[model samples]
Structures are given as structure tokens and as C-alpha cells.
Target: MQQPEPLIPLAVPPDWQDAGSAILGGDGVRRVLVLGAPDAGKSSFCRLVLQQASRRGRPASLLDVDLGQKQLGPPACVTLGLADAAGGVPGLCALSFQGSLEPLAAWPRLIPGTARLAAAAPPGLLLVNTSGLLKGAGRRLKAAKIAALRPDLLVAIGADAALEAVLADHPHIPVRRLARPAQAVRKGGNRRRRLRAEAFAAYFAPAPAWPIDLAGLRMEQAGVTPWPAPRQLVALLDGAGHDLALALVEAPDEPHRLRLRAPRVESPVAGLRWGGLWLDPGWNAHEIPRPPRA
Candidate 1:
């Protein structure tokens, strides 16, 4: 593959510049996992690494495991993108739907989904960019991801005791610690929510409502009860279990069928799994409360 063309130059910290160069300078580092708290410049650092690799004519890929603020594809999905630096975010190559915006709520799907997508990345320097969830259980999730991916290098981007704790779990892997660059702007909670809302709106903007018959396809709600109300998010899965598209529930016109506002599904939908949120037509997301313990 032709090396990805360079985008606008990024002004990162001097140490970050050296780290990016060193990574591509060929010390036998292939798979790299970048971790840090929110707004710590993990994504920016990955972009820098990609640009450096591109300049050197090295093929590189990015596995975006951040469901909320993704570098490619929509929120709530782990996407693999071949590094094409011409665009701000790499082009979408593959994805796995975790169905939750928060990494904590999605760990069951997050770790394995990341591993699966990382496995599918095209051969080259695979840079895995993860969600900035580094407190409490989030710390364990980060460590679990490292254990699963077993990346050649772990790039922790900020100073957090939690980050050190995670690094301690895997002593064998080489690590590069860098301060969060000044360019990294800390987004407030409300700002983050607005960003997610905008992303959802952009993703579904051109989609038309599609009606699906449940007669032949498998329907999986599993532990979810009372059936999902209108506007619930759902994932239509292919036979091999990859997501075909995400749809919002609409009132069914017929029994044993579902109407959804989603992009056209070109391939057959073998099954669908219910998500734990409701997304209104206006793109606002509301969590679906879990059923009371039996």
C-alpha cells in the first residue's frame, strides 16, 4: 500500500516528537497501545506517529477502541482504520459494536472487541488508541486490554497514578511515558456529550427507515425484558457476528417485525442484539435502565 499522505503538521511537545520518531525509527516495535486519561493527547500522539510512519513509507494502521470520542467511525463502536493521514481521522476499514458510550458499561464487549479488531488490522505498525477511562474499574479495564492485545509497546500519555498501576501489571513490555501536550484541550462533560450527540446525528443523517422481518433472522434481547421501547439502539449483525449497521427502533407496522431508522443493510442480517440506550430522532441519547434483579 502507498504510504498515507501527510496531513497538516501537528505541534506536539518536543518529547512527543522524539517518541514518535523513535517508534518509527525501527527498533522492532510493530504493535503499540496508547493509553491515558481524557484529553491527555493519546489520539493526537497516535496521529503524530502515523504521520511519521507515512513520511518514512511505512504502512501503519490504527485500531480505535475509544467508543465515545472515536478517531474513525461512529461512537459506540471499535473501528479499524488504515492510516490515511490525508483526512483528520483514518478511513474506516472494520468495526465492532459495543453498544455503550461508556467503557465501564461496555467492558464485556470492549476488551474482546478490541482484540478482535486489532487481530484484523493490516500488517504494519498497529497503533491501538484506547478510551480515557483510568479511574477505579476503568483502570482494570485498561490493564485487561493490555493483557489481551499484548502490544509490543505501551505508550502512556499522561501522569496519573492509575496509569502507573496499569503499567506495573505488565513489566515485560517496553513503555514510553510522555506529558500531555499543551495542545490537548480538556473537554468538559457537557462538551463531550454534545460531541457524541453530533457524531450520532452525522452518522444517521442520510439514513432512511428500514423495516425488517423477524421471521427468518435471529433476534437477541437475552437479559433485556419488556421489549425495547421506540428509539432504542440496536445492532444488526452479519453471520460471522460483525455489525452491519446500527438502527434506532421504530414502531413496527406488523407483528414479528421491527421498523428502524438506519442505513440500508446491503448484506443479510443474521441477527440483532439490543443496545442499552435509546437514541431519539434528535440524536439525544438516553440510557436504558437494566431490569431489576430477579
Candidate 2:
């Protein structure tokens, strides 16, 4: 693959100059994963990289694995897009994982979904935008993800002293630290909820409520046990278990059929799996309330 071209002369800010040159220079960096705390400007930096590529005649795709505060796809899904730097968030291809706000509970699905998205991305500069969960188990998930993707470059957007221990194992990979953009805004709970709601609304629009037979499709990553509860969020998947669409289990109509509200699908669905997400009619995620005693 042709090494991605460097930013057009004087196009990048002084802060990102070295990193940009490093990525576009010597041997050429093909894959990169940008890490940072919440509101640390990871996505902002991603836009810069794509902008440079756009101006220099280089092609690139961005793989966004952040389930919340999503820019490309719905909440709880890992999505990718061939970006237009000037256009901002582009058309998305999604792989639905666990749809909760936090990624910790969905590590099993997140890692594989990330890897699959990375592998499927078109050849060029593949810039990965990660979530802001950067402490404790979140750190471990980051470590595991690095090990799995084996990116060509690791860019940390802020003070990464906490990442030193986990990064110790990968001495061969180079890491670039960039200061968080001063203009980046820190999102509050209400803002986060609003953004997540917008993403979910985009997913549920237009498609009429549809009922599907649970027996016709197979389920994988179906969680620890089968759930028969109402209003639980379930994922419609392909035979290989990629997300085809998301639905609410309105009710169990029979032993093998479910009443649901889901987006229409163009292809046949091969699996029905629930991620324990209890979504209200608006598709906003909520805690699964206790089951009433029989």
C-alpha cells in the first residue's frame, strides 16, 4: 500500500506538526489508535488526520469503537466510515456490540468487533478513535485492544503516565503524545444523554415495528443466559454474529417467536441475541428493572 501522504505544507497546526510528519513520513504509518480521557480531543485529532489526507490526495478510513458519545454510528455499536475531512461524520457501517453506556461489561464483544472493523477497513491510513474509559478495568481493555490490533502507531492525546505500565510490553510500537485541543468541550451527563439519544433515534427511524421468529435464527454472544423479560434490547445478527439490527423484546408471543420493534433489514437475519440492555420506547438505555414475582 502507498504510504499515506503528509499534510499539505502549513496545513497542520504546530502542535500536531511532529506527529503528522511522523505518521506521513519515514516508512509511513498505516494504522493508528488514538487514546485519551473523556473529552480529550481524540476525535478532533482524527478529523485533522483525515483533513490532511484529503488535501494531499491520500485516502483514509476511520474506525470508531467508542460506544458512547458516538460521532459515526448509534450508541453501543462499533462503526467505521470512509471520511470526508471537510464533511465531518460520514456514512457509517456498524457492528452492534453491547449497547450500554459503559464498555466494561461488553469487553467480550467490543474487542472482536473492533478487530473485525479494523480488518475490514479499506487500505490507507486507518485511524482508530477509542473511548475515554482509561482507568482500572478500562485500562486493561485498552491493553488487550492494543495487543489485538497491533497498530502501527499509538497516539495518546493527553498525559499518558498511567498508560506506561500497560504499554511496557510493546516496546516496538512508537507512541506520540499530543496535547488535547484547547477548544474541545467537556461533555456533561445531560449532553451525553442527548447525544446518545440522537444516535439511537437515527437507528430506529423509518422502519415499522417488525416481529421475528426466534427459532429461524441462531444466537451468539447471547449473554450468560436467555432472558424472557419484556422491553429488553436484543440484537438481530448475521450467521457469523455481526449486528444486523437492534430491537426491543416487546413480549414473548410463543416459545420461539418474539414481538419486537426493530429497523427493517435488507438481508436475512440469522441470530437473535440480547445484551441485557433495557431500552424504553425512545431507544434510550435504562437499567433492567426487577422481574415481578410469579
Candidate 3:
């Protein structure tokens, strides 16, 4: 028997012309949500739509809600940016999530984060690139976002029926389904983890180690674990849960303070959450799921 084709490829499908037409067709302002399973060409499709829209000189904004597969910002963040943002990376601003790569673990944050980031966009068309968590809780999470955002068009890029539940729940909203891209490369678990480490390193590259005085720090939310007394990774967040800095916390010399090895930061720290990850001096990461659940 002949071998079957792989699920995803590194190139977009040849029939993408229809996808573009259906997406950009007859629109004053197209509010779109491009969603699908992991490596199902969600990001590729988003870039394609943006390119086509730009050629027509139509302005557009982006709400990157995929914490794991993110091009708009570092992993564990939801970034809001413009199509033609002047600066590099186009990261206008970011919302801190649960510091997780998988969508289910971070769904609680993704729901509110999507709305908050979308709200930051100017009044015009928007394209939301979502995490590829399209079954079970993932479907429910994505569906909830559609309900809250009420986008005009939904572009689902794969043949999977995972999005059907969302579409049925939202019968009123229009949906367009496109085949998975011909060249969407699917990376294995190790590759994904390595990519995350690279992103983490890059995000913290600009600034050096900084410290925080826990005695004066006020937190609106925190992890359940007992505060670390030794070196451990943590995410510094604002009241809105946007990560301001990533650091390695060292035992404090003073009762009210903790030391951090991180980059320069501007946002005031409203809270600190212990990272389920441990980053050595080399910045390599390993996961620790059940860190502090108290």
C-alpha cells in the first residue's frame, strides 16, 4: 500500500486563493478569528490574510492569543499589535498568562486575555490567531471566546471537526473552513520545548538581573505554593496579569525582600507567581506542573 500524506506541511495548500477570497470577500471591516488544531497552519493563514489585506491598503490589527505557538510575542503571553507596526516584533503590549504552553492549562487566562488584548486594538478590523487546542476543553474555551468577541468571520484552517461544536453553538456567526496548508510543518514535543526556551531567552535578553522587595510588594493574585526561599523561576505581573518580567528568585537577605536575576522592567509589580518551570544559568527550561496548589 502507498503511504498516506502527512497531516501538516511546510507550505500552504495550492487552493489558498479560495481561502483568501472567502476571507476578504465583500467586507467593510473583516473581524476574523483564525483557529484550528496545533500545526494546522493557523499562523500561516493569518499572515496570508494580513498580506492580502495590506495590498488592498486595508488596515488591520492582530490579537495573538496562542501562548504556545506565538509569533506576536514571547511564549506565555498574548500580544496585541498592528499589521504594519513600525517597531520589530510588533508587540504593542502583552497580557501574562498562566506561564503554560498548552491551551487547556492556560484557558482561564486565554479567555479574559483575548478580550483584554482585543479591547486594546483600535476601532477597525481584527484577526485573532488562537491556540490549537481544538478538542474537549479546548473546544469549549475557543467557543467561549467567540461568544465574547462576536467576530464577523471565523476562518478555521483544517479538516478537523473540532471547530464544529463552536460553529453550531454560534449558528448566527459566519464561518469559513479551509484545508490545512500544504507546507505546515509539525514539530515534535522536543522541538516545541526548545522553541519555547529560545523565546524565553530572547524575551529576557535586553535587561539584566533585578531584585524586588517582597515586604513592599502588593499582589492581587499569587500561586498556591509557599513562597520560594531558594532559587526558583517566577513571572512578575501587573494587576491585569500581564508579565512585566521573568526572573530567577534567590533567597532574600532581608525578611521583606527577594532577589531576582532578570532584565530591566518598567511595569509596577502587582503580584508574583512561581513558575512551574526552572531555568538554570543557561536558560534551559523543564516543567513542574504541581508546583504550589495551596
Say which candidate scores most in TM-score: 1
The lDDT leader among the candidates is: 1
Q: In candidate 2, how many Å is residue 108 off?
A: 1.7
| TM-scores vs. true structure, each candidate | 0.89, 0.82, 0.80
Candidate 2, residue 222: the lDDT equals: 48
The C-alpha stretches of model 3 lying farther than 4 A from their native spots are 1-30, 85-89, 228-233, 239-255, 261-267, 289-294
Give lDDT per model, in order: 0.79, 0.72, 0.67
Hey, what RMSD does candidate 1 come out at?
3.6
What's the count of clashing pairs in each model shown?
0, 0, 12
Worst window of 10 by summed lDDT in candidate 2: 1-10
Cα lDDT tens digits, model 1, 160-255, are 998888888889999999987766678898977777777777767767887888877767772254565588888888988777777777887589
**Backbone clashes, candidate 1:** 0
RMSD of each: 3.6, 5.6, 5.9
